[model samples]
Target: MIFLAIRYLIERKRQTLLTFLGVFLGTMAYVAVSGFFLGFHVFIVEQLVNNAAQIHIQARKDYLSAHQLDQAFYENSYRHVFWYFPPSGNLGYLEVQDPQSWYERLARDPRVEAYSPLLTTAALFSLSKISVSAVLIGCNPIQQQKVTSIADYVVDGHFRDLAVGGNRVILGDELMKRLGVGINQTVRVSVGTGNASPFKVVGRYYTGNRFADSQAYAAINDVQRLNGTPNQVNEIGVRLKDYRQAAAIATNWSRIAPERTESWDQQNANILSVFRIQDALRFSMIATVVIVAGFGIYNVLNMTVNQKRQDIAILRSMGYDTFDVVMLFFSQGLILGVLGGACGLFAGYFFCRYLQTIPFMPAAPGNPQGYLHISLDSAIYIQAALVALISSSLASILPARAAGRLTPIDIIRAGG
Candidate 1:
């Protein structure tokens, strides 16, 4: 039966080749598209993961409710004292009240790999005659390096240079460009009408993010002095042993701790949503192509069954059972699927390699020349092969069944 199926397919070479092409192209397309989108998705996710801390803890602020306000102001002297507008906003400086306690707690927790206490301040940086407004983040160099990938991005000097702590600063590439300053140059930094303090630029880093590149880093003590809030930290960045557990840990910390805690994904939910949309689009596009390919297979096999009705009837007269006839035609579909899918895998691999060679740069400042991130993951090829085999098998079923049900007597009567 298998030998007969092979002979039948070989006789109609043109239709068979066209059907094979359809399955081949469909599988190849699926592999290539999946590789491209999934590669990019992984790249973005890695950036989000490594560029910053897994969890952020902000300074705590307490607000008074209306009932509490009434109790404090009226002292229960009057029954009702309603105002046109309710009171709002917290009272106190925006500095963490007890950062030392948090430091001790995080150090003792096994889940926390490292944590950095930061005092962020908006300041004006001036060099010679140029001035730029950027954020100045104060951190301990060693702890900051452990909490984020800042050390990897340092281009001019070592990140540990700031640890000298004598008013040293590390400027971002873009921020240094804006101020027209270089390493070892002195820059004047001032916060909120205070006296401008001179900080020597010791290093420079480039993160490829425009906003991030427009920032600077300094020692925590220097920043506190410059901002006129000595020994105060406004935020704490925490890196977890297992980043995937960040959300749950952050939620638990927020409920128990005075400071506000948020996971990395929670901070960048918008970007994650865009990734989800890209996934849906990638699958839908490949699905459409595969469905079209399936139709091509169905048409070719259906035509073959019609044209070979006499041969099928002759086999039936020779006592070929319905099951045997069905198996013969089904074998043709299986052969096409297996061969086409194999060829498609090779083609897809070469195509992905070609894609990687094409030069492309993301729309980010300070980014170096690079190619597209195309992933040749094994799962992509496996999925492509499965799609091809299943679609082809399903397409062949109806025609195979139709051929099986055809009676030798019916064909003879029609011929007469």
Candidate 2:
């Protein structure tokens, strides 16, 4: 019966081949589209993790000004030999007194890890004898170095240079490029305190993140001296020994330091929300492609059954059961699915590799990075194949059922 089925399929080779091609192309489209979307989403996640700390803490109840408006706490000493404790502050709550002592006590918890107190004051920079306003960052170099990539972010000179009392500063490559300033060039910073102050440009750095790289870094004490707020810092950047503990640490800090602490998720809520929305959109697109491809499979299988009606009837007369004929046709669908799925896997991998060589693409709105890297996973292939199989089988089902219902007498009458 199998030999007869093969011969029947061979006699109608053009129709059979066309049917297989249709199914194969549809499967390929579905797999390729799904793979691209999945790969794109993984790329965005990786870029986000690389650009910013997995977990960030800031003052709650403060919107855009969480980093600047809150009265954060600070500790005079490092919590541990490795940890440099920063100040803490409240946003909605009345400024708490003795926050320094409060943070110190909290640091004693075993769950606590390395943390740094920080303050951020938005200021503008103007090169001496030049007219350009650039953003200025005033942070504790000692602690900022431990938390942010400012230390490793440096391209020339050291972050420690900003720690000195002499109004020294570090500039980003982009900022310097715009200002036409180089290392050792003098630049004046007008921080809206009273008057513009002068600081010597001593170093340059790049963080790869466009926003971070488009600013200047100054000493925390220099900002303090200008603001006339002694021993006051605005922000604290915390680093956990185990990043996986971020949620736990956030919950602990929220319980202990209520109304003050905010995690990175909360800090960057707008951007994170955008990521989520884009993820949904990508998934929807992939699903739509798969559904359309499933329809193509249905069309192909329907044609196959029509072209082989006589053959199916003859097989039934030769003692081959309806179940056997159904299985035989279903095998064709399975073969097309397997072959197409394999082709799609290779196509997706090479397509991603080709994308990398091109310039960075503009991602969802507010995502400043121009390009992203695609991530490939083994599970994606499995998912692609599974989808292909299900679609193919479903497409073949109606045709198989139609042929199964055929009577030998009806077929013989039609031949007469």
Candidate 3:
């Protein structure tokens, strides 16, 4: 019976092709759209993970201006004392003075594997060759490896080269490309409103993310010397020996350094919101595609039933049962959907691969990476196939029921 049904569908070449086309379009739309969003989301999350560790600690909300243990120790006792004194106030906006050895205390805690002090300050970068205003980041290479994966992001040069070059700095790949710079090129970088000094470009790094790849990095002391910001950092990246300890660590930070520490998730609330919005948009788009396919299938099957009334009647007169007649039309729709879905799957995969190859940049609201990486996984393929099949089955329902309802005598007389 299935073979006979297949033969019947093959005989109606035009109808078969049209039905297949409908399913094909639906499947392709689903796969391509979903693949793009999935790749885009993964890219953003991965970049975040690379730049900042899973947990970040920042100054908490405090009525007092200082993040110190207490204002009294520094204000009265250490105010006039220059030697072995705390860092200056204005340049120490984000600095944490561990007079009480807070960092050392946290280091000994089993939950914390590593931590890197982060310095963020906007400074006028007046390189000897070319002067450009850029943000400067300072990090310790040894401790940074424990927190951020900066070492892995170097595309062209080594991180240790910055140390070797002394006054040298690392430039982001895209920024370096914009500056038309090469390794060993000397550029002057100054922090705050200070005059710039020549700093050689010791290395270049690329993280496959435009934002991170646009910033420049120098030693922590260099940033402090230029900006007059001493013994202070904007943020601290904390990597747990085990991620499950993150909540416990966060709780500890809150108890110890209340109003001054935040988890990475808390810090990245805005980006996480963006991901949620994108996910919702993707779902709506997929729903629209499935609905459109279902409607097309419904229309096609209804028209086919009207045109095949005589044939249906003839089959009923020749002893075909209602169940058999229903099965025949169901098989037709199923075949069309499955074949179309197969074609769509191939087309979508190639289309996504092509997207990866083309050097095209999306507009301002989109990422500046200029490439979309699509994931062609079994889950995506299965989703595409199911959309086609369900749409096809739904469309054939009315027609199948109509055929089954026809009595042999009434159908034959009506056909005549």
| Predicted structure with the largest lDDT when compared to the true one | 1
Error of 1 at 340 (Å): 2.2
Tens-digit lDDT string for candidate 1 (1-416): 88998888899899889888888887888888889989888888778777898999998667855555776778866348786776777854498778888899899999999999999989999887888999999999999999998998998899999999999999999999889999999999998767899999999998878899999999999999888788899999999999889999999988877788899999999988988888897788568656866787788778888889899999999999999989888888888888888898899999999998877866332245568888989999988888888888888899899989988988888781
| Clashes by residue pair, model 1 | none
Instruction: Quote the lDDT for 290 in model 3.
Output: 67
- lDDT of model 1 at residue 220? 95
Per-model TM-score, in order, reads: 0.90, 0.73, 0.71
| lDDT for model 1 | 0.87
**Candidate 3's residue-wise lDDT over 41-110, tens digit each?**
7766655655677677664434333334344566766445443453344332345645236677666887
lDDT of 2 by residue, 68-183 (tens): 32222334432322323332443353233344864675478565455555445666777656656656656777866655555766779998888886888888888888888888
Model 2's alpha-carbon lDDT is 0.63
Candidate 3 lDDT score at position 257: 57
Error of 3 at 338 (Å): 0.9
RMSD value for candidate 3:
8.3
Candidate 3: segments with Cα more than 4 A from true spot: 61-93, 97-114, 121-135, 152-157, 162-168, 171-201, 204-216, 221-234, 239-256, 259-277, 307-320, 362-371, 412-416
Ranking the candidates on TM-score from highest down gives 1, 2, 3
